[model samples]
Target: MARRRASNEELAGLVQGEQTDAVRRLEDRVAARVLGDLESRFAVLSQRSITAWVAAFGSVQAESGDTAALRRILSTIRGAVRRLLGPLGPRAQRELDQALTDAVLLGARQHAAFVEEATGRATRPVSGRPSRGLRRRAAAIGAAIADRRDRALAILRPSRARRWSDVQAGIGAAQSALPATRAHIATTVNEAVNEASLTAIDHQGAQKLWIAERDACVNCAAYSGMVVAADADFPAGLSWDPNQRGRGKALAAPPKHPHCRCRVTAWEEGWAPEGVPSFPDSLRREARRSIARGWSLPTESGAARIRAARELLRTGAGLPKSVEEFAALAVRAGRFTDRTVPTGP
Candidate 1:
């Protein structure tokens, strides 16, 4: 007996899963390079600052020091920050460019393999150059890092400083830059894949479908499994309403918002995979459930969450008991959008 061959769906799942893993690994690599460099630089700066201050003021923990000496030390640290960290943007851009090239190439390869498997023909190769959208995002993130460093330096500047505690507070404020950089790295990687998918779709003349993670935000959920032509834009406006009455501009691919994990895959008629009820239908159902359950609605905006919860209530759809309770409570008391709301298994 011969071994069984996997169906188109199985093959697609295998390849797509591999691509997802590749994207993650690329993201980790870029982040490690950029962030590890940042951490090391900060560590060196911190150590040198301590050593300098201790040498001049007798101790880094001193409550008060010679005023002119403290000013001079602070000035030196400012110069050091500019000298040591000023190149961060250019360095990060280099990392982003390289990682995006790899990500795009991998996407192109997987997509070509899938197309060949589905239709037994080879498609054109995708360019590995980062798309303009991706470049813009990278530049923005790099600029933000530099801006944060500058702001941190501003805070570290002596303005009638009385204690080392104040210096510590400034450093703490500066550390806020790290989290946003981490999120941006994820966003940039996802966008790179999205760009590649779009290019592959163009090369193969295949339709593309938006794929949202199961626990995706309401906005991303709205696009889950939505199929569109290669040249067409997914309809604009991201709203939680089942009808999706949003006013935002149309999008070309995944990353409906910052830090979005949504993706896209090629779609064609008669290639629907086996063992799933219906991919598009399932995604639509999940979106409905997300709205009804108030899952991932406006984590950053309390007012938006309350509005979304209220809209869900007004839709006349049957909300789960807990969702109804919390939606009502949230509407009654405009708060707690970030609170953990259960998403059913």
Candidate 2:
């Protein structure tokens, strides 16, 4: 028997799993590079300091170490760290850029293939070139890495120390800082990769997209089954950023926060599984409720207005009628106005 093809949902899950692995591998690579550099620099600095101390005191023991020589050694180590920052920042950025480019292209191709399989429509491959958004995100991550490195150096710098134990304690502190930095790199880079992929699919002509939550927590669970137009902004009320509430521009797309595991996928009409909320059905219900209630659309908040427009569109009547038109009509009539809505092909 011929093997049955995987369903679209299954394909989406597979894509999410693969991308997660890719992100983890990229994180490991970056962490290794950073820790390796730190170790090598510290080794060099330690060797030079030991030699200088012996020459100054005519002995290699910590008891023979002169205070002035110790200060000079600390200065030298700090200088080396500063010099390392120049090269390290660019190297980390280059890694992030390449990783994000690979991830976006992979996601775009996978989504396009799935769409073609389900809809019998062809999709062009996304270019591997880095996007402006990707570049900006990479630069931000690079700056963060530099800042963390500087902080780590500060924590690791030994105070007026005459013994090896004091220096070792500082080194221990530096090592302790790496775990948090590694976590930060992973989450930030993963978010950038996901955003890039979503942008790629949007540019490829997806008309609608749905959120695919993975092991969702309470916050993301509320977004489950939500669908929106390809180009429409997510409802402001659903924004993860508190400052973005009521602001239409806060989150234009999915994976709204750092380390958000939710994947946004192309949505096909009539393809949602049972129990999944259909956008049209939900919109119609909202419209009916709004009409039944004496709610002022014009005075309603932005979130309310968006909800009203979506409802109007679902009733097969709101076409050519923008959100503003719907709000104005609601204000004039104090009720929902029924009109013929244009259906998409």
Candidate 3:
């Protein structure tokens, strides 16, 4: 007896899983480089300056005046921001260009292999080069990093700080930019991978289905299992009511928002072999589970969580105990009467 060939769903799942891992590994590499750079530069700037300041002024209140020492400290902060974030953009761009190109190429090959297995016909090879659009988007991500750096500088400006405590707090806020940059790069990678994957699907002349992760946000969950022409957009919008908001505008891709890790897979009714289950249906089921759970919503605002819990409860879905208690508190606080739903971006 011959060994059985893997079904299209299985292959597509493996390809998606592998692609996710590749993106994550790339994120780790880029993040590690960034963190290393930040640590080395920040230590030189912060440790020396902080040590000098505390040695000169024994108390935080002693540095409350706009004196020469304070001026020097602010100057140090400006220098620190520049040194820390100046090279981050180009560095990230280099990593994205090389790693994303390879990852997209591998994903394209996997998608092509799926088509070949299903139809027994060799597909045209996909170009491994990152598209001009992807390059432009990656550059935009770099620019975003620069923008964050500027914002951090603004936060640490003299007008914003008086005492050592204020400067320390501002520096704390500025350091948040590092993690934000890492998150932005990771989101960009997902967007790039999906764009390349969809292009590959188009090249293979196949339809595509949106596959939301099992714990995706409500916005992304709404699009799970959506099948569309390779050239067409998925029917639902990224956020808000799918029936009322952005329909037919969102292109078939994984990320409906920042940090979205959705993926796409090829789909054809006839290509699914006998005894193979429905991939789209399985995805939809997972999506429903995500919506019902509602505890894993991405929003951090109490109002947003309460609103989500209310909606889930209205639909007769069970909520986690914490969510129920939160909603109950909002109801008691009379916040629930305010009918405005928080449509997150």
Candidate 4:
């Protein structure tokens, strides 16, 4: 048998250098400068654009199994935006789309990891505590409703609606997933960031950011993205001063409803990479200051993380090994497919 040639250290280093450059190229993603929301969060859009393209590719290029075909498929999707963006537009779009797609896929891999972890820890060694405060509200609401029901019965009246939409309003505090919560916060933060950055942020982009935040808040339980900050609102002109990784943005309770677990996070205009265009300090300090908020929980009984873990594992086995796999599993088990997980009535 012929002996295989070994790669020397210098060649290995050069190869590693090239690999790193290629990877960094792939990882670079920029959200559109558009002001409006895209259909979902920036991250989810990032994931979905890639997912949809990849799925389309998988469907179209089943037997050939060509890796180049995947890139080409992504190229095809990028071509449509080229009119508005030019040649480099495709690359940026590809990066954003691929990020979202990869995130979902990695999330599945984490699902499998979560399953591996689940058989051990009795409870996740997580960040925030599940609030006893939520139960207090639920009890308070339930009791008040019950008293009304009792009073009406004594008067020979029909029991008023037990399923009042407002009754479970306080349940948002019950949700405890970290990654998912982070996604929610991340989506919102991205929006606020864009608003803070772009002169004229695209409306479609803004919508996509919201969808991403909602989905993250309600779906996966990995990272608790919701670190409620001191501000409730944000203005445009976004910039960051590095250190966004462990940085915590101010969060506030959403204005929409009482049970609303929706949260908004705000960052200092210079919190990210230096030289990125920033919003006005008025946008920064005084006008529309975002606030901090409470929590996220299912209205109905939340499936234990263990159950969520089990569901993740069962579906994540082989199929595409991505969000679709999880989605398929959820569908088979009769679970709802929430694109924007931070769902509202």
Candidate 5:
């Protein structure tokens, strides 16, 4: 017998799995690079700090310590640390930006190929300029690193004793901050991959998308069967879109939190089944009620409006009015807030 072609649902599931794996691998690679850079820099800085401290205060007893000499030593250590870390900000931003861009573009191409194979339609390649979200995410990573560096500086401040013990304690404290810093960078990579995947799906002309929650946690379970239009805002605003609040204020798009395993799948109009039994019934009822209460529809525009309304009914949000509006809302809701980004050191 001839080999059977996979159904649309099967293809979507396969793509989702593959995309998740790809993103995870990319994240791992990036995280390793970041951690390595941080470790190397920290080790060198710590050694230099120790050498400077030993030369300045190794023999001086606490009681006989010259205050001015201690100040000069601390200042030298601070300057050395600052100089060593200065290049990290730009390096990290560049690494993250390049990695995210490459991952997203690769994801877009993968989505386009799968779409073409499943539909037997020749689809256009995603040809737009780089996503602005990439830039914003890069800047966020830079800011996070700066904040961590500041904290490390605070920890390194010389105590009144100016003893060798004090210098060693400060170095130890700064080193202890590394694990949290690594986790933060890892989370940034996770979010970038998600944003890129979603962008790729949209560029492939998908009409609908659905969240495939990891289903391992309460938050993920609540969002498990949620679906949205290709252009609908994710993590739908709580004040303006109360319906999506069921997923929780903390839940907005995939990678809802660090180490999130959720994925999104896309569908074209005819490829997907009409009935989505998995969707929550309460939301459907609310959508219908909302449409009923809206302004009157024009007779000529009735069919189009009805289609839009039906889409909203299914997804729990109106179809995005325009691309610009969708982009704005997606960025506002999908990207991480300052509080979510980790501050370590």
Candidate 6:
């Protein structure tokens, strides 16, 4: 009986370890491929349009000739957008084209209509050139935008929803395998250390962390990387391919705050990387380090932070008590406290 019980525990650990390794390996492959494509796309957009847009906006602020200024500003804005979202081909183009077109065309038409009503003759307000050419260009641009949006919208339902569903399903399938992965690790650990019995490492919480980091990867400018729940057991860096570009770190203990189910996911550029008002780097640094330190949550403030984290995670910010319960469990896990923060080059 003792032998059987030992076998069962050993089996569980083996299973957990295998699942962790396999999922981590597979996730690395998927993330690298997908994120690389997106990064290339974003880099292209950011590089081409930002300069001209900045110039135009800057010129306008400096009180350049109003008409020329308006022309440059409008042209810059239009060009920037095209540079950002220009399709790779039919493959990437879809419903988003229509949305873009609808918005751009609707805007251009509004401007043209206003211009015609006021000036009577169709002429460029600033250039004295016939407005026909400009309006035509605007119309074309608008249509292009709309076409892109349309394409995006059309495929969006299937591509995005389905992709997400598939990943989630993959996550579910992974749950059973975690024990296998952990078992291997447990055997290895058991040989050397007898600290604690291995339990389900925060698999659910890891998924949540993945989801959060995914969002930051998509939208956050300063995104450095993700710090996840202590219980969630994020894939360790040494365990993964060193070639993967992302930075990963382990927390010392569970989260101290409510719904703070995970630790901080830092972006390299910090928040508001699109040149909007941003948080102070020092403040951000301090906040991340402080959170990583694993102090107990200060009742109300901790609760609010947890709620905010949930909101950030898009988990619908469930009841405060629920978030708190999860957070407290994390605290008990003793995994949240210490972590290394990587500064990206």
lDDT of 4 by residue, 1-345 (tens): 222222222222222233223322322222232212222333342354345544644532333244454445334333322222232223333333334434333323322222223122221211221134322322233233333333322322112212211112111111111122223323432222222212111211211111111212222122222221232232222112111122333222221222222222222222222453222222221111110010123442223322433443443422234444454455356444332222232
Cα TM-score of candidate 4: 0.20
Per-residue lDDT of candidate 5, residues 1-345 (tens digit)? 223334544453455457667767877787676556667776876677666666766653343176776777667656755665566566667777777666666556655655565555665446333468656866676666666566656755655336766655555555544565455555666565455556656765564443442222223333444566767745532211233334445333565655665555455556433454222232233233323222221211333223433344345553334532442333335421221111231
Worst 10 residues of 6 by lDDT: 191-200
Ten consecutive residues with minimal summed lDDT in candidate 2?
291-300
Which TM-score value belongs to model 6?
Answer: 0.25
Model 5: lDDT of residue 90: 66
Error of 2 at 305 (Å): 32
TM-score of every model versus the real structure: 0.70, 0.54, 0.75, 0.20, 0.56, 0.25
Write down the lDDT of every candidate, Cα atoms only.
0.68, 0.52, 0.64, 0.27, 0.51, 0.29
* Clash counts for all predictions: 0, 3, 0, 73, 0, 67
lDDT of 2 by residue, 54-123 (tens): 6766664555345666677666656665665556667666666666666666556655555554445565
From the highest lDDT down, the ranking of the candidates is: 1, 3, 2, 5, 6, 4
Give one digit per residue, the lDDT tens place, for model 6 in 125-165.
11121133223422343344345434433332322323323
Candidate 6: Cα lDDT at 223: 25
Using TM-score, rank the candidates from best to worst. Answer: 3, 1, 5, 2, 6, 4
**Displacement of the residue 15 alpha carbon in candidate 3, Å:** 5.1
RMSD of each: 5.7, 14.2, 6.9, 28.4, 14.3, 27.9
**Could you tell me the TM-score of candidate 3?**
0.75
